[model samples]
Target: MLDEKLLSRALLDDDKENLMKRLLLVCVLGLTPLLISGCQSAYYSAMEKVGVHKRDILVDRVEDTRDAQDEAQEQFVNALEQFRSVVNFDGGDLEAAYNKLQKEYDRSEAAANEVREHIEKVEHVAQALFDEWEDELEQYTSQGLRRESARALADTKSRYKQLRASLTRAESRMQPVLSALLDNTLYLKHNLNARAIGSLKGEFAGIKADIDRLVIDMQRSIKESDQFIKAMQH
Candidate 1:
């Protein structure tokens, strides 16, 4: 009886070992692929949340901002044209017209400032991209990155000069005609002479010529800026 019991125990031990081995193999075969697939799915989902598709959602917002900027520029140009038609401030209605001019100046200043802020934001983001792009990968932001940067600076200067010129012109228009007017003035507000207007116009002509040169230089700088920015981003 003892011998019989020993043989039965040995057979039972063998069956247990085989069952465990089969269970382990089944687990490895079934679980390995599932584990890998789960990891892959999670990685893709995370990327989708923070990747290019997420960024593209802002495309409309960017477009809207650009559209608003264009409208502001149009309004500013119209206001400038209107200024050209004005008879100097001596028309005895000085207060109203002067106030209106001031308001337009404020409006233009606001719009220009908005554009500057937008550009600043773009620059800031471009800079941030360097962590990933410049070190390891390449990123695309603008073709004229270098140009935009240089132009941004130049545009800032140009806008400032234009604002200053506009302010001076506003003051000149308000000046009592007798204070600066001699004769042959193109603009007349009542008995005021027009010589001072011609003189002012000449000064502005020179300033405009300078502005044109600055603009050309800025344009050239923009291309170089684009290349530089691309290099840095990449």
Candidate 2:
């Protein structure tokens, strides 16, 4: 008799637990859509408060850097063309090649200056973005934003990181090319067609090859910067 009563009670308890779960689930299903709608509405309404205009400044800055890099690459190509004009590999025209290299050096220098200006502009925009993010975080935190605060902070951090990476790549790409152009020309004057120029290369073909590689790398870097800017705007 005791065993029968215990079994009946256990079955009743299981049924009650199952019923409660279904009711709870039904209640949640009914409320989920309202909760989701409210969240979306709140998100857009919140984003407007962190106002800083990215209308043209950010894209324009990246585009300017890209243009400068392209121009610098073209100038390098022209430098190679100027190099091709030299009469002979003999020690005779060494001075002439040196003078030609100097002109190319000056051209490359101007291009580097433009790249620097664009980079500075990028830095300025990034700093503004950083300030906006901090302001928003502080304002929201004080108001007990909780989950929204965490999400906003994560998004802000990601944006800052991506922009920083893009600029770092641009600088990395531009500096080496500039330095290589300068150093390569100097080495050319010393060893035009002989054995290794500073143990680096033996002929014009090698210089052309290295320069070609740099051109390709610079193109990739500029594209990355453009993508990064687009990401920030979105």
Candidate 3:
């Protein structure tokens, strides 16, 4: 009636102001986490400079990695059991079976990711420790002490090589199991009928074989982790 154009312009301006405020808030919130992460990393770096050292960090990370791998092994076993159950599923609520499989798959995925992350953490600290040791060798004034330190570093590296190989092998074994899991999960998701049970039957043998292999690999990795931890403790 009166000044409709002026009223619309005012409303548009108000909306823009609110939108800008929201965007500003979102950016600040997002940056806060990144800022905190940077601060934590800086703190660790500072601690290392003060003689806390990456060797200590490596030991902690290795223990964490070992525990994570153990947990992952349990999770994968549970997922395999669930997979076996679905394949042997008789006439029952198809939805329930699908849900269980989905849950197990999600859990397995999370556990596997945790294991991989822990391994990366261990590797990061280990590399930093080794590099620092090598660099510090030149700073040694006494020839006898320098030689001793060099020998210790070489021995540690050799042991780490074996441990890393075992851990990596265990990590690599997860892919086949995960792939098998995804295949069955997707198949069930698409065909949520009784036939979905039958569809998974053909995959059981291969999955069983994969799980058996995974279990063995994980066991070997765990043993390696224990030995490495013992070596570090000594």
Candidate 4:
């Protein structure tokens, strides 16, 4: 009986251990998104400690920002096409058409947000790299090396200023597009008829112009991003 009791207790303990392991695994899985989202600064600092500095991060983030902008441009183009289609609707369930346009607007907004987030990441890393470079200049023992480093830092700052200006202009362009999209979506949500479509038509030209300007700005920003990344690589 004593031996049986011990055996039963051991099995119970084993089961409890397994249950705890499973619960821990479940907790980790549930927290995955939070872990991924938390503390970019910590991640950057940890990477820096391991020799992966901010310059490398800046290059990666610039590319990411460029890609995000490209995606946003594509999404906006798609939304524009959808808007055109809705404006041309002859005889369909106007509510359904409005719903489709609304979905496109939502998608465009999400893409624009992604572009902004990538740009912010690029800015964050670039600022860190520039600040670190500037601070390290005082630490240089050799005057000649210090002067050379300072020159490089100044040149990088100039190029970065240009790049950041382009990026910010592109970001600013997104607002008009989003506003137009929201206006059209909201108008259609309420109207859902020929009059609503006609009303949107009057605004289409303005929306198109805004999109065209946005595209141009995004293209310029992308070019600047490529140039900056190439410069950082060297």
Measured against the true structure, the TM-scores of the candidates, in listed sequence, are 0.37, 0.56, 0.81, 0.82
The C-alpha local distance difference test score for the whole of candidate 2 amounts to 0.57
- Candidate 4 lDDT over 1-234, as tens digits, reads 211222233334443455443433332233574663454455555444434567766776787889889999999999999999998899969898888899999999999998887777677678878888899998989999999999999999999999999999999999989998998899889887788888989988999999999999999999999998899889
Q: CA shift at 97, candidate 3, in angstroms? A: 0.8
CA lDDT, every prediction? Answer: 0.37, 0.57, 0.77, 0.79
Best by TM-score: 4
| lDDT tens digits by residue: candidate 2, 1-234 | 211222233334443455443433332233575563344323222222223143234555666777777787787678666655543344565666668877987786787677766677566655655565567665654555756766765775676566556556645555555676667677766665545232433345655775677577667767777776676567
Question: For candidate 4, what is the lDDT?
Answer: 0.79
Supply the TM-score for candidate 4: 0.82
Candidate 1, number of clashes: 9
lDDT of each residue in 1-234, candidate 1, tens digit only: 211222233334443455443433343233575663344323223323323221221222233334444544454554443344333334455445444545555565565455444433333333333333233322335657755555554543454344334323332322122122212122333323345344444444333343344334333333333433333334
Candidate 4: misplaced stretches above 4 Å?
1-41
After best superposition, candidate 1 residue 3: deviation in angstroms? 86
How are the candidates ranked when ordered by TM-score, highest leading?
4, 3, 2, 1
Displacement of residue 189 (Cα, Å) in model 1 is 16
Residue 100 of model 2 has an lDDT of 82
Highest lDDT against the true fold, candidate? 4
Per-model tally of clashing residue pairs? 9, 0, 0, 0
Stretches off by above 4 angstroms in model 3 are: 1-41, 49-51
